[model samples]
Target: MGIFDALNTSVGGLQAQSFALQNISGNIANASTVGYKGIGTSFEDLVPAAAATNRQNSAGVTAHSQATITTKGTVSRSSVSTNMAIVGDGFFNVQKPVGITDNIPVFNGVTNYTRRGDFQLNANGNLVNGAGYYLLGVTVDPKTGNPTGNVPKVLQFQNNFIPAQATTSINYAANLPTKPATVASTTATAGGLKAYGGLDPSDFSAGFNPLVIGTPAPPFTDATTSGSTVNNKQATQISGATLLSGAASTDSIITNFAAGDTITVNGTPITFVASGAVGNQLNVTDSVSTMLAKIDSITGATTASSVTNGIITLHTGTASNLTISSSNATAFAALGFASPTTQARGGGGTVGAGVVIGNDIKVFTNESISGGAVTAYDATGTPVNLQLRWAKVDSSSLGSPHVDTWNLFYQANSSATGTQTAWINAGTNFRFSASGALTSPSGSSISLPGVTVDGQSLGTQTFNFGSGGLTQYASTGGTATINNIFQNGYAAGQLQSIAVNNSGLVVGTFSNGQNLNLAAVSLSHFNGTNYLKALDGGAYAATDESGVAIAGATGTINGSALEGSNTDIADEFTKLIVTQQAYSANTKVITTANSMVQDLLNVLR
Candidate 1:
């Protein structure tokens, strides 16, 4: 009975060793498999019951497969963009198709988890691994890039045109030079940069006003007749009292007016008569005071009409531009004016007209610096180049109340000609303090309403410059230094391709060069991974021993890469040698037990 017991125990030891060998063989076979978790054998010893605890005999040994689920595998780079790899302890949620229905894979509604991430887009645009399991993920809102729901499902992407989105706001940032090097700058060279066709500071109303910054006043003409002194009289005594008739000895006469000479004030004529003239008519013998009154009455001048020391001065008085011409050049010369003179009133500037025509292009170029340019999209997804320029209006160097002020402009038409609207003012005076910080614009954004570029209207949009995005620092180049400028809109484009990103999100690259988030790859974890039911192709199923799959996992996914098998060939081979030796040793024990049984049989005979 003891020999029989030993024989049975040796047979059990052989069976256990065979089980261990089987596990070692499987590990060696799957050494090159992707995302394979190696299995090891755990031996358990069986003890036979005896009368006394100290007299217990060894029954046999049993082997159980041990799961190496927590062990990580080596990750290597792959050429496929959609391929993903897990670097930690989580598995990708996937599903296997039960059958094909109408050429589509029908899911069995059972969720499975796997680490084999050799996924590629199938015919139906679903992500499937080599083992035919479809990948599952949560949908994401393309605009917000946020997950739509917490539940993970099979993801399918279609190659359809996305609707066009109009631009609402632009994320912009840039710096402005304190001393802008404009064409009208005083430091400009004369050889190639002459002021002839360049913008002059006088083109701007605020820049030309003497009261605002002093000096550089408008051209005022006060003509004197060659010499101010007349008829050998004292210099201060000569004025409107000077006579036009050269024959009068007591009257102050410089240049004599003839009887047929005519002077025109704003196209209204005043004729010289031999004698007894009235109503837009001046007598040859009339005094300078009489002629002045007739001229003022014809021109409707309320102010700036005077004669000082034989000099005639006239002003348009803010009502209209003054145009004075004369049929008789000599008579106009005597009147202390050029033959044809036109002078615009104060407060008139082309830059304030909100539209810069082709005739004013040279002036605009000379006054403004290139701000930047960006291609923006409209509601129809029409792309337009939004070109901008900055014109420095006021400077802090001009003292208090005159900080560094600038006006923004955009090109309305590229080919605009004379009197055609080419540029439009943004209508806000951006002011900066002496410390180069924005002072007037209290917020981070500004409105550009009805922004039309080159005949295309982009409607209204906001330029969002985050806090401290704009600065007015000193630069040696004296140009606007653009730090950053971008828009939130894009043209309608077809879905070109999709790829998994490092953030575990599936991004779709459109034909219009925009990459948008489409879905978030979901990872699942289990408390008892080793207790999971092993499925085909490195997949696992939930069981009573293994807890339910949790949604959030600490593992990270890598794009364009894959995880290798965790099985080591060298280690498996070493275990194989040990298993062979144990199996042979068990067989020897069985043979010795058989020999002992033979000897006992011989004694009984």
Candidate 2:
């Protein structure tokens, strides 16, 4: 009975070793397979129960397959953009077709998971791995580029026509030099006062050109008052302690202002009250600075009236005109102003009359500096080159009331002759403070309304200078330093190529030079990965032991790469030698057991 038990146990051992050999052979064969999780043989021993304690007999041994599903495999670079690899624990949600209908694969609606990521786009635009498993993903909205649904389905991308989008805003950032170099800049070799078809510098300086050779009469000086006169130089101070009231001995003017004496500026009267309340009235005992404030307030001048080196300067800015007339002629003359003096505002004209006729193109070319250029699209996908230029309209160097100001221009027509409009002004007075920061429009954006470039209308668009996007700093070269400039709209485009990004989103590049996210790759993870029932092609199906797949796996997807099979040929070969040795040892046990039985039979004979 003992020898018989030995034979039966040895037989069971042979069967278990055979099972292990099969597993080792399979692992060695599939060592080159992609994303393959190798199977290992697990042996369990069986023992027979005895009537007394410590008297048990070995019955048999059985082998069961062990899954290395949770083990990681080596990842290698792939040339195919659609190919992907998981660096950790997760599987790609996929579907297998049970049949074909009209050339299209019909799925059984059962979702499967796989680690094989050798996916390539098929003729139907669906992603399929080498094993014919279709990849699934969440659809992305073209406009928002966000996932549309929580559940994932088979993803398909087609080359459909995209509608044209008109540009609404241009993000622009640049550093404007304190002094931009233009053809007409005094520093440039071709320097001459240029603007609006050679509009004379005298026009900007109120009929006086400082750049001229000869010593010209200062425009701020009246006919009777010369610059050489007392307290009339460019640097003379007329404010502070200097009084304009006749009651004060230190009077600023030859004829001091008396009570009831009024100075009317731009149709608003500033009355010199003896001692007064603060409603637009200057006290007779107040300083000349008080009188200057009243004048500046009435004219709405951005550059206020100031006296430098006793010389008084009045500016109209670009918003309004400057006009000063006094009820008392002597008092007005004492303030160094001729009765009824007037100065037109710089860069102020008809609001929408932005165009300069062909006659003024030469003037514009010489005066304006290139602001920058960009290509924009219309509603019909037509391209329009938006060329920008900056023209210095007014300068603080001209005197008080004239701040550094600029106007933007664009090319309207290249071939306009005679009276045909060739250029258009943006109709904004870009005023800069002493520190070169924008002070007008009170915001980061300005509108270029009704912009038509070379007969192509590009509707209204906003030019945004993000907070601190535009600056005016000292430049090594007297040119505009553009940091960034681009538009948001693009022409119609067709899908050209698609690739997975590190974020696991499928991005598609279009023929029109736009890249958009098309879909999001779905990653499903299982609680008990080894409990999953292995299927063909490195895929796995959920069993009762393995919990349902959970969405949003923690593993990262590497694009343009793939995972190799986990099976190692060297390790499987070592296992193979051990299994063969174990089988031989079991066969020896049966042979020895047979010898014992044969010896007993011989003795009985």
Candidate 3:
């Protein structure tokens, strides 16, 4: 080969070696960079001129492009909850705010995708990355877990409406007693008052005093018959009429001499046996005493007769006036007989006063009265009397019970104080009428507004009976899958195992007792992936030159475990040595050519 050709070849070799050295430096520098892939270099030969027009000739050394990088790398487990790494082929989808002219770049919006999984939560309670970009997915209702395509909702607080503790009231009902009646009769005798006939006789076994009429004389002898009627022996027949007119008449005997007539003479009571022997009356010795007893009996009869207008008047028909020698005048006073201050009969005519008696119903002045007039006085002394038109039965007001709907003052929080800003029923069942009222149906759940969490405000959202009805997502065959994505981020987890199904979903097992979908790692089988353009950071942006990425599983790429780095370190070192040797050989060739030319000039001289 020509010395010029050798020099050119050595220079090309030095350039290729330089390129390989650059790749090795990069690999060493980023050896610990997460998800970092290493690079490799390749070379080709340059063809020389052909001997003939169609003759083939051997090529000299030249370097080709160093465009591609080895994307294979080992993914070590991280200790962060949100740190995730893609195992197979796909990228994690993230959303970032672009300039106003940008249409919020999406995965399908001509923006690049990534596999880095570090994330955080923003002020709006949305999970985001360090760039303040939201994570993208089908928005899920936390309660329902249904796919709300493109619309995103976030969770930021907990439940706060718990019923407060309070006290309860009680009510009661019971009974009371009644009143008694009054007495009427006036013909009661003095002894009759002591007898108490309606009461059992055993009640009066205690001895009682008999009513007295007049003073008795010693040796109270019975009166005898004076005239004798003849037939064979001078028989004297004293007639009843004559006996009645004599001392027997003043004997204090019960008049009419009828059965059941109780009478007292000289403080002793003797019942008259039926008209004994047509006038067999016991004779009293003292005619004055006998006359006094008779007059006293007549006085009792007259008193009984004079009991008109509830009063009794006493009068005497005998020459000797009747006198009461007993000092028990208070007993007579109890009988309503007292000396009158007016007319003089004995000393003065006595009159009796009647007793005021009945049920004695009392009317209270402050009692609650039905249909009463209420007199009210104003501050200006204006007397206003209102008449209550309705009655209260069983303590319940029967008229239209006046009610005013007023706000209940309360404090919602330590800083907030105001009346409840809603209309509330003023009485009874607060929210229902006696008739049919709208009710929250059974098994229904209601949600209130969301509260602040971690110093960020989250708005209200709710989930109720939807078209799928009240069903538990875990039990139902719905899209509500188990997702343990916490509000913060995915915590540190080791890749316990990896799984791939026919649907191209790459599910990863974690050491933290969870199974997560690392990514829907899609695979595209091209005529060749070797021909695809290489973008840095282990990504490949699609171009029209390469057909659309065919979604597939890892097995479609004809490998289970990934390929390690294609970097040939030994070959690179050998190439470096070869390049050094060739450069030295090329310099020697240039020197030899210069020396031969010098020798030719010497020979020519």
TM-scores for the candidates: 0.81, 0.70, 0.32
Candidate 2 at 182: error in angstroms?
A: 1.0
- 72: Cα error in model 3, Å: 2.3
Residue range 1-605, candidate 2, lDDT tens digits: 99999999999999999999988988888888888899999999997889976787668899999999999889999999999999998999999999888988898889999999999999888999999999999988765787899899999987755678888889998887766666666533333334211223332323222121232322331111211233412245644667775433444455767778888877888888778638779887787677777766776655666666666677664445667789998776666667888776554223234456676666666666788999999889898898887777666655588677677777878788877767777777677788988777578998888888888888999989877787777787877888998997789899999999888889898899988888999999999989999999999999888899999788999999999999988898899999999999999999999999999999988
Query: Which window of 10 residues has the lowest lDDT sum in candidate 1?
Result: 207-216
Number of the top TM-score candidate:
1
Candidate lDDT values, in order: 0.78, 0.78, 0.31
Runs in model 2 deviating more than 4 A are: 187-359, 392-450
The residue pairs found clashing in candidate 2 are 197-363, 198-363, 235-308, 235-309, 236-308, 236-309, 236-310, 237-309, 237-310, 315-401
TM-score ranking from best to worst? 1, 2, 3
Off by over 4 Å in 3: 52-58, 65-71, 93-108, 114-141, 144-146, 150-538, 551-605
Candidate 1 C-alpha lDDT tens digits along 1-605:
99999999899999999988888888888888888899989999988789999898778788899999889889999999999999887999999999999999999889999999999998898999988889999989887778899999999987846777778877778898887778677644452221211233445443222111232343432321222223323245344456666654555455666787787777788888999897889888777767767766765666536566655666564445667777777655655667787766654432234556677687678777899998888889999899988877677665667567777778889999866678877777788988999987899898988988888889898988889998988988988888898998898888889999898999999998888999999999999989988898999999989999998789999999999999988888888888899899999999999999999999989
Better of 1 and 3 by TM-score: 1
What is the TM-score (0 to 1) of candidate 2? 0.70
In Å, residue 26's CA in model 3 sits off its true spot by: 2.6
- Among all windows of 10 consecutive residues in model 2, the one with the lowest summed lDDT is 219-228
In model 1, where do residues sit more than 4 Å from their true spots?
Answer: 186-243, 248-342, 346-359, 415-420
lDDT of 3 by residue, 465-553 (tens): 22222221121221112211111112234545444333333344555444554433323333333444544443445456655444432
lDDT of 1 at 244: 69
